[model samples]
Target: MPTAASSPKNEITIVGAGIVGLATAFHLLAEGHRVRLVERGGVAEGASFGNAGAFAFSDILPLASPGMLRKAPKWLIDPLGPLTIPPRYLPQITPWLVRFWRASLPDRYRASLTAQGGLMRFAATATQAMVAQADLAGHIRADGNLQLYESEAELAAAQPGWEARAREGIEFEHVRGERLAELQPGLSPRFVAGTFTPHWQTVSDPYHYALALFRAVMARGAGLVHGEVTGVEADSRGVRLRLADGQVLNAGRVVIAGGAWSRPLARSLGDFIPLETERGYNTTLPPGAFDLRRQLTFGGHGFVVTPLSTGIRVGGAVELGGLKAPPNFRRADAMLTKAARFLPGLRTEGGRQWMGFRPSLPDSLPVIGRSTASPAAFYAFGHGHLGLTQSAATGKLIADLVAGRRPPIPLEPFRPDRF
Candidate 1:
């Protein structure tokens, strides 16, 4: 089953140890291949650690979808708004944002949504399979996710969108007033109507899931290195990873899944990936009287509040801050304050904040295929806010690409050089 030639000792080096990298290593090991996963920091301790944890099935809209460009200026003005661009970093990322604005055209938007939707559907199944194989069912919760809206007018206006999604086979049911209370008694009565995507799921802790994957892969005898890969050297025979410490590790193929920090690593291999970090924030509260049964997304606030087994967790926002900058925890605190408006009983004062990067491209679709620049290198980053939803499927696609097998989905839409 191994694809690394006839020698079992051949190393298949993976450049990042986030969800995508670890999952790819898992799949490769499943196929009897030896792998070495190298991370810049601790495993899964990057952006993958503090995600909102929603296993979204209908998060079909791309970040560059229509109607976002006009709202950008306003969203940037309001500090409490869903999207923000820090004044200091504007000069550096403006070009990328301009390209992103252009990609928001209807044609590109539709294509991105379709491709991401298909990948997300396949990812849901792959997630189930991998989790079951690792026996991590305890960390997974099957409670369907609810998207709440306070205004009936807004809900009515969004009908066409929901109907289109339904036509695409995304299961959902409408909930209003009393029905909303019946389904989630903790929600504020101000939320007049909402939609419940019964197919969606959530993980109690993303770190726990990553830990599970790490343990499973290590148990199967894969190797892991704690270092940053500064460069990737590719040739006809294979690829070699150049680490920060100047050590080289050879592999038949290399996967770039370094999240927001992927652009530079990708560039070192001669690919120009116009990627930016959509920095997201999260707040974790100590256990209190507030208990929630399902994941909650406030349409008005543009954030999600999920009931973590430890305490309540709130995370959202798209700040154009680079990956290495210090995190502004105020955004996460703002999320808690915003959550209080939706659930009157929810406390806003007693939680700590965290921030991490979400790798984003001008177009919402991620780069998930072989590179035209380098035959032995592969690209799988840029999932935006849907990294968790897209990770598993991306891994399977990478495995199929390396094995030279037909991918489950067409690869043209996600070509690395579409720029």
Candidate 2:
């Protein structure tokens, strides 16, 4: 346990200011708990800000689904593939890769879906409520999303997964041939089919949403500190967060939501969670040239091109390289190249390129509960690609667990010790 008496001032200290951390602060503040949030960088500037902006309730499949392992090798060879494993870093990534491969087994993949789908469903409602409560609904759009395919072959190959979606109660409207073009006229002539998910939604500006959450927490008088949490010390009374700046904050409980940087901090608490980062890239195109009716996904390619309030944004590419590796913005450029092929009229007159790491676990399911070894220490990170979609629900669960209350969603499925 950590002692509140151990600090100069008693407060709950949450490490990392990504969406997850900020969301946790919002929930804790709503419960009238004093909170101290420490961030090494600006909120949402990490992986959260660069996401495709899709709140995909219909996307319940894990990344380790069957048959994906066979495709991984070819993707790694292509510099512009949606998924890539750098040759130099392959040795370091081998173990994680093996674990991920094992997770691709039929039994494990279904289990992951059951866990992810249930959590994401709760996340949908929690996210909506948070936006409304924080008055941040201005940034959100609840209209659905579309995943378009370029060929009949692609559609047929994906039908099994879509069928599984139906069994999981995920509703989808299949659009093919002329019907697909009718829904979105701007699509390329090459598009043959698509799936319309009425439950999918998006945010206009993820950065603004993150800032709103941060401000909401601050308005409640919670301290938002700028520093890195280096270590944690626990005793009979409570937990103490050791900041890099030499300042210490004590809390009756602690939640680690450090995004891609969570693994090391998690280890300090005795949970060596096998967490990794999937660095993703994005690019923004100027307005007039790229006018998409809704967010569009290249089903076979796994990237998305969305028409935004500012401009058209193209993003997606999973790089297994670690967090510190230099960003290869070429990946974003490649995405732009692919986007142009899908939308003939799209043009990029010099756009901003960005890269960020989504904290990922082997099975794509986030680590989202109390540590078995350290009950006082909780984990709410490793949301991977679904951080933006899942943050609010994760925060609510963490808050409920810290207060010794039962979470509306089950926790054991995402327990830190599940590995």
Candidate 3:
């Protein structure tokens, strides 16, 4: 066995430069560890760049809920619907689908909900600290977010989720009738009811926010390496990363935070995770296209329209296409169509379409613990839509685990070996 002195003292190398990876680097740097970040592409170019930008802390419900299964048939039929599975991608994702179905069972769903709710409870404070540390306070808004329902029937259908949230101690204000307009004057009269969670926050510019954190990490003495990590090998001493360009990097510890691309590395570490890519789409309208005081989710249309520093961003939609498939921008166009109808007066021209992969697990829970195959390796991916919301808290947890300190929250549910 290799001794501790064989590796550099207090050094850690992290793979992936997305929000979660950058946030982890920041946290590890604060702990007096020398850190290095490796990225295949430019920073924040993945889901971090084009997400809905809402820190949906109140949305603790798992995506693979029992109700979602009931609606799957209808959604799958519509190519541009909120959720669709490409017929060609079905074979590749069938095992993940089976796991998703099992996770939707009442017992498993409750357990996931409880675990997710606990992690989200620390979102606001953790993210606020990171924002302040990274000097990104200007990029964040704490005005809350709203989920709109065009009719009372639509709101009634969402009661189960609301009840689950209530059981988890999640709070929200129910608005109906004329009160909706008072809360959001710019909203269309079609929205008769809404649920507002004041604790939900939004990033005025998600890409910039991530970049700020990345720069902060560099300024704090962490090095950033631009290369593709093809494989990772860990042992009792440390870990070695093989780059595509025939370069090898070694560190005292390694963290796999590659988001949608983490599965292969996890497998190399002897952990087989049921991680799948949820291809999500977004469209950002031209500057001043519309005015929105807070982020709004159109419940019936299953999309979110958010106010950003650059423009009004309309995003939301799930396509189960593997990583190799070309992006289907039509999904983004469909979101724009829904945004136009949700806000009748909004301008939808001069917008850019984007699509990125969201790392999703069957249970809708992130893997955030030390690797079972190697003590020097850690895992922190499979966050799906909550990556931005949970990044800071996950970073703190990873730092704690690496330093051999007890985590602030329970880690049993998020163990890498759980699957």
Candidate 4:
């Protein structure tokens, strides 16, 4: 058993200043530990800044499910489809794809749900706490989210997912006609059916939320280093970080939370993980592009329309095009086209497109425990689309682990060595 006496407060260095890294720094600083946060770019520059801004606690289903393999061929062939895999990248990703297939088995799928549910159970409360602490309550809305279907058959086809959610005790209400229109006015009449989950939340500005957290952590005495981390070396006594500019920094402990760039650092520390990048694209319209009271998902279209402080953001779709691939803004345009079809009256012109990489693993779970290679090193990356949703809880759990206190949730499922 781990004890507090065995793990005293020490100077800590955290790599990556995205949502996850900043959240970890916040927790550690609150615990009276000295913390230094390192980032290649500015804060919230990656997926943390451009996400859909949804705190989707009810979306516990993994991306790889039983029926996905059957649809893979079609999705792979359709360049503009919701899921795309570049033909050139197939050989490089085959091993990871194989693991993804095995993870989609009935048994493994259920286990993933259980493990994901355990982490999401803390999502709502933790997010609320962080928002309140950072005085970012103005940037969040609790109006819930809607998943719309165009026809009865389409709604019927989603029964299995609803059943799974029900088994997990997720609350939802089915609506149509007047009820749907009452909840979301001006919606197209083509959306004949909808499912609403009131427990879901949204951030009016994801980048602002991250920046608020970063400022709060800094106020609490955490240092920020603006440099690209080239390598990391860890020993029993401490960890050393190498920068691209030939600067070296050292700390008594280190946490590697560098989203898509984490693999190289982890490999240097002797822990190999099957981390891949899920290239995601989004388009942001002007402030008055559409009127939306809450977040809306066009299920058939595989995209979400969220009301943000800046404007309306339509984001979704997965592309396995690695980190070095050029941005495919065409994917963003396709989403805008779909969004226009979903809401015929909405303006789709003058929109800004963006592409960001989401760190992902075969099992759809983040690595969130001590690295076997070094006791002073910890892992907290590969969160897929749930990075913003699980950031606060992950931060608290990591703080507990570093302090030698038992985590609120089991770490076995998210262990770094599980791969």
In the range 1-419, model 2's lDDT, one tens digit per residue, is: 64554443456778888899999989988987878887888877888876788787778889988868766777767877889877888888889999898899999999898888889889888998998898888888776888887778888888988898888788889998677776678787788789888788888867767888888888887787788889876666778788888887777778899999999888877779999999998997777666577888886776888766667789988999987779888899888888888888788777888898999999999998887666678898998889989999998998898788988877777888888
- How many Å off is the CA of 194 in candidate 4? 0.8
TM-score (all chains, Cα) for each model: 0.95, 0.95, 0.96, 0.96
List where candidate 3 sits over 4 angstroms from the true fold: 1-10
Error of 1 at 88 (Å): 2.1
For candidate 3, lDDT tens digit of each residue in 118-232? 9998776788888888798888888898889988888899988999888878889899866677667777777889998888989888898898888899999888899999988
Error of 2 at 380 (Å): 0.9
Cα lDDT computed for each candidate against the true fold: 0.82, 0.84, 0.88, 0.88
Per-model clash counts, in order, read: 0, 6, 0, 0
Ten-residue region with minimum lDDT total, candidate 1: 2-11
Off by over 4 Å in 4: 1-9
Select the stronger candidate by TM-score from 2 and 3.
3
Question: Which of 2 and 3 is ahead in lDDT?
Answer: 3
Once fitted onto the true fold, the runs of candidate 2 whose alpha carbons sit more than 4 angstroms away are 1-10
Q: What RMSD does each model have against the real structure?
A: 2.4, 2.4, 2.3, 3.4
